[model samples]
Target: MRWRSTLVAAAVGAAALLAPVLVAPTASAHGWVTNPPSRQDHCSTGAVSFDCGGLQYEPQSVEAPKGSMQCSGGGGFTVLDDESLPWPRTQIDNSVTMRWQLKAQHATSTWEYFVDGVLHRTFDDHGAKPDAVVEHTVDNLPAGDHTILARWNVADTVNAFYACVDVTVGEGGGTTEPPVDPTDPPVEPGDCDVAAWDPAAVYVLGDRATVGGHTYEARWWTRGENPTTTGEWGAWRDLGAC
Candidate 1:
C-alpha cells in the first residue's frame, strides 16, 4: 500500500510538472547545431552538457527572440552561454566543419560563426533556400579552448537560430571527455579483441565497441582500419585499459 501510494504521488507530481508543456502550443522552429557539438547536440547524442535543461528533449526548439544573437536565445537556455558553468568541451582541430540540421528549409540571409566574441567566418546564403543540412568550413582559428556561436539568420523573419558549441582546438583534431556520471558504477570492458576494431566496420558518432580488453567509443564514422595504429584523429576513444 505504501509503495503504491508513493508511486501514485510521484506520477501526479510529474504530470503536474509536465502539464504546461504537454498542453503548450506545438513548436514550429526545428533546427540545431550538429558538428563540433552544440549543447543541445550533445544531449541529443546521449552525452551530458553539464548545465543542460529540459531542452534535451526538444533541442531543435531552442528559439531565441528575433534580433538577439545570444546563445540560449535569452531565457531558459542562457545557461548554454554561461561561461561559469562547466560545459563539456569537444576537441577539434583548428579547422573544422560546422554543420546544422534544419527540419525544414528556409530562405537564409547568412550563416555566421564566431569564436571568442570575434567573427570567424560567414557563409552568405542571402535569398538562398538552404538545404536541410547546412555546412561551412572555418579555418585559421588558433589552437586552444574556445566557444563558437553558430547563428542562422533568416531572410524573411527577424529571428535567428543560435547554438553555442564548446571546443578545444588541438594539433591532432580534438577529443571530448563525455560528462557521464562519475558516480555511476564504472563500466567494465569485456574481452573483445583488439582486432574488433574492424576496418570494414562502419562506425558512427556515439557508437561503442569493446576491443583489446577496453571499451572504445566511435567519435565519428569509420571503417576498414585499425584505429589503434592511427594517430589522435582515429575515430576511436579509449575508455581505459579495463
Candidate 2:
C-alpha cells in the first residue's frame, strides 16, 4: 500500500509538538522506558489506538489467508512497527537503554519487535492486557526524528498489539536530556469558501486559514485567470489567512 507523504508529514509534525506532555514520555538519559511507536509511521497499515497517554495510529488487521497475521476482533489498536533503528527519537550516547511496553489485544498472539522494520525480538503475549513492557538497550542512535513501529504477528479480536517505549539517553550525563519542544497539535485543515466532502481526496487551492476548531488552506482550483464560478475550493469562509 502507498502512504500519503503529505499526511505522514503532518503526523510527524504533530508528534514533534507533543513533547511537553509532562509525563516525560517514559524516556531517560541512560535508563529504559516503553511505549507504543508513533502513529505516523503506521498510518499506511494501522488504525488509531490508545498509547502512552494519548493516542497513536496503529497497524491495520493483517489480511487473512493472504497473510499469516490477522486481527481477531476488528483488530486491536495500533502496535509498534518501526522502520528505523532507535526510531521515534535519537541523539543518544553509549550508556542509554530503551524499553517499549507492548500491549496486545489477544493474550494468545505472539508479539514481534522491529528496528528499521526488521525483526529484532519476539514475545508470546499470554494475557490480553493494555500495557506490556518490552525492554531494549541503545548503544548509539542517530540524532533526529526517528520512525519507530510495532505490530502483532497474529491479529486477534481478543488481542491487541502495542509498544510503549522508554528511552534513556545518557548514563551519567547530568544534562544530556533530549531537547524538548512544547507545542499543540494543529487543528484539522479546513476548506476555503466552501466545505468540500472527502478531504482525503482533494483539498482546495489557496493559502491556509485557521479559525475556531478548523484550519483551512486557501486553495485555488483555477489558474491565473478567474473562472466563471468565482470562489475558493479548499479555502474557508470563516477563517481568514492561515
Query: Relative to the true structure, how large is the alpha-carbon lDDT of every model?
Result: 0.70, 0.34
Write one digit per residue (lDDT tens) for candidate 2, span 1-242: 14688888889888888856754654211101233333332232233333311222222222122122321112233233322323334335532333443333233344454444444334444333324454433323333333333444333443333333323334532223433223322344344444433322323444443334444443332111122122232122224322
- The TM-score of predicted model 2 comes to 0.26
Clashing pairs in 1: 91-174, 91-175, 92-174, 199-223, 199-224, 199-225, 200-224
Per-residue alpha-carbon lDDT of candidate 1 for residues 1-242, written as tens digits (9 for 90 to 100): 99999999999999999999889987577688888789888876768746466666767776765555567767567667667866779888767888899986778777778887677666555456877887776655667888888888888887778888999988643234324334434544543553455544667766666665676766655543354643343455666664
